[model samples]
Target: MYHEQHGAPAVAPLAGFTVGVTAARRADELGALLQRRGAAVLHAPALRIVPLADDGELLAATKELIDNPPDVVVATTAIGFRGWVEAADGWGFGEELLACLRGVELLARGPKVKGAIRAAGLTEEWSPTSESMAEVLDRLLDEGVADRRVALQLHGEPLPGFVEALRAGGAEVVVVPVYRWMPPEDLAPLDRLLDATVGRSLDAVTFTSAPAAASLFSRAEDRGMLPQLLDALAHDVLPACVGPVTALPLQAVGLDTVQP
Candidate 1:
């Protein structure tokens, strides 16, 4: 299929598919893009966003970093680290956090994390070739973690195995939980989305983030709808992803994907 964009036609494979859009925010861009291609959209934002509250946890984490200043600061996501640092700034310790950053090498997970690290005014010592957590652990361990202090800003649901591996490598790992991804507090819309997908009413199901896909599946499974939902998404439903990273776990679960 081909698309005409800004007066120039684009040869695209996905010119007429009713793709899903699941980005956390600023979704209108992708949604509009898909609409122009003569495809219907389903806006089932599976992940809920919550800004940090009660600065105590962040303050504690920052003080711990400043006092001990981890040998490696592993940032998993750009948005998360920026939010963490901004909250730290609000606490009047922005410079102190930057001072602590200067004492340690930086390891970012993906380009997003790399951008966040640069946003913090630090240079990257290393980052994973892939955004996947497994790759990040492999690279950091290769470098050496023995008796080193490492701080991790968790992205979603905590990568325990990665944390466990670093701990096993004898690194004192401290964590900063900037945000969490969970099911919508109300299950009505999600419940409806699940039924629609399972019933083959949705034209496509696009996921911008893994947690959104995860949230849907988790809820469906709890309600005994996993197998059905998965089957529907695999066959009649289209699974579109914004990028390779967003496509990871969905592919892990056998969902065919169309990438933008």
Candidate 2:
């Protein structure tokens, strides 16, 4: 039973619950949302988003792609696409890059990626309903990528295997990494989150990206607490993700997840 105070409703649904947030870009916004629902928030950004401007390799890759446009271009993530465009603009090659992309057959992973491509004054020739990178590769392979030049705008993590798959299909693949995910500079916060998780002090953990989740798992493995952490998450702490893609890693470990 609960009682109201000062005309306010008693016991907000999330009262007495603690939720962990692992988003670097919008961590504060997510924390605020959880707080409004009466939950105590714990933020531990497992991975930090490094912009293309700061990554020399990524900048050079973008330049190479702009200089030599591929026959097909695959845009994976909205933020990654936006970052690539912004970086090229900063380098005084925005127009040239856009023009190059316009000449290529563009493929988007999903609506967000399609929106980013369209926003850049370019159009996507194809997009899959499943919105998965595997699906994107499958469609391209189905269309016969032999002897075609394909450029892929990589998201925050590496996709060497995906590149290999394309290469095996007889396509010359050029990977343009727009951004990357690095472990947080400060590991103290993440350590605390792991402690809480293992102690069953958290009610739920929210992951916005697959890399972040993978980073957390890697860190736990390093500390020899991977089994404990996984057990806690499975039995006590509810794991939540923003989408299926982010849930893939957790699902691989036979852990159930909640996602919108």
**Candidate models: Cα lDDT each:** 0.78, 0.88
Q: How well does each candidate superpose onto the true structure, as a TM-score?
A: 0.82, 0.90
Prediction RMSDs, each to the true structure: 3.8, 2.7
Best by lDDT: 2
Task: List residue ranges in candidate 1 displaced over 4 A.
Answer: 1-16, 54-59, 128-133, 251-260
> Per-residue error at 118 for model 2, in Å?
1.7
Question: What is the model-wide C-alpha lDDT for candidate 1?
Answer: 0.78
Q: Write the per-residue lDDT of candidate 1 for residues 35-124, one digit (tens) a residue.
A: 766666666667786666564666788888987788888888898889888888888888998888877888888888898888789888
Question: After superposition, which runs of candidate 2 have C-alpha atoms over 4 Å from their true positions?
Answer: 1-10, 159-161
Single out the weakest 10-residue window by summed lDDT for candidate 1: 11-20
